[model samples]
Target: MASARLERGVVVGARLLVAAVFVAAAVPKILDPAGFAAAIRNYQAFPYWSWNGLAVGVPMLEVVGALALLSGWKRQAGALLLGGLTLAFVALITSVIVRGIDIGCGCFGQSEAAESVGWPLLVRDLGLLAAIVVAAREPGPLRAARVR
Candidate 1:
């Protein structure tokens, strides 16, 4: 019983962590779409024409997914969305490193001092992905075991 309770706690904690990450990542992009678009363009993963759309769309998705995770309704779906986004980020970051392109991660926001893409960023994204996967595997909040 205690083990179950502990597992539930871990799941809830992971969910909240992932939710916070998504929300944090989304807000800056939403607030400054043009800057975010430039950041996306720096990646060179997508065409210039698509930057604006992606800049707007990605942040919106992050907000919606984060809200869903926090609300405990459709949490699994949110986790899946976050997981996919994290995977894409890891891939993009990896590509930039492999290609020797020095650019901001464009993850948190579009700041002039945004951190450059590197292995640390890739590891962080992978960690978030792991958290999402763990949270997604658990039952919903109400079904989680409660410790005395």
Candidate 2:
């Protein structure tokens, strides 16, 4: 019973942590989309026409996924979306590093002092992916022990 209780606590913690991250990342972008759009443009990954669409959509997606994670019934779906987004971020960051395009990662918003994409950011995103995975998979119900 104690173990099961601990597991439940950990899972809930993971979900809250992941949701918090998404909300933090989403808010700045949601407020200042044009700057975020410029940050997307700096990536040079997507076409010029798509930048505006991505700028608008990505923050909304983050908020929606975060909300879902907060809702017990929709947690799995939320985790899946957040996990996929994290993976995509990892890939995108890796691509930037490989191509040697040094620029601030437009993750939290288009701040002048934003951190640049590098191995550190990739590792962070990977950590987030792991947390998302944990949040998505809740432990099975505990069974009672029987004695002879």
Candidate 3:
């Protein structure tokens, strides 16, 4: 039916948009790991030594997830992971905001404003979550493996 085609088109568009956002975000952090480490430090969440680890690990995960989303490979798993990450971010940011701890979001590295957990951040995370949820709801294009 025409309606089915329209729905599929919408889903595909949403997937691409979400993948693009993650890819864009990952590039900056990947390009400047040291800067991103500094941004993590600004967040004041972890110990001094852990910032570097997070800076490296976080971006790697983001890049992988972004690629998976873009490729439509293991789509269900990738979308679920992304959705969980977004939920965690939303929770973390909300907690920081409630505690009145103003600091950089460190989302894509440090911002000139030292991006705090503000309304815009919340909205962005929520949007990402919604997109991931939509992606997960669709049937994955990947083939299933047999356990034997």
lDDT of 1 by residue, 51-107 (tens): 999999999999998888878789778877877888889899999999999999889
Quote the lDDT for 77 in model 1. Answer: 89
lDDT of every model, 2 decimals = 0.87, 0.88, 0.76
Residue 40's lDDT in candidate 2:
91
TM-score of 1: 0.91
Model 3, TM vs. native: 0.84
Candidate 2: how large is its RMSD? 2.9
Candidate 1 C-alpha error for residue 38, in Å: 0.3
How far in Å is the alpha carbon of 50 misplaced in model 2?
0.4
Instruction: State the lDDT at 62 in candidate 3.
Output: 77
lDDT of 2 by residue, 58-126 (tens): 999899898898787687888888888898899899999999999999899988789999999999999
Positional deviation of residue 137's Cα in model 2 after best superposition, in angstroms = 1.6
TM-score for each candidate, following the candidate numbering: 0.91, 0.92, 0.84
Q: Candidate 3: list runs displaced more than 4 Å.
A: 111-114, 139-148
lDDT of 3 by residue, 2-62 (tens): 5555666667878888888877777888888998998777666679989889889887777
Top candidate when judged by lDDT against the true structure: 2
Tell me which of candidates 1 and 2 scores higher on TM-score.
2
Candidate 1 residue 50 C-alpha distance from true site, Å: 0.3
| Residue 128 CA displacement from its true place in model 2, Å | 0.2
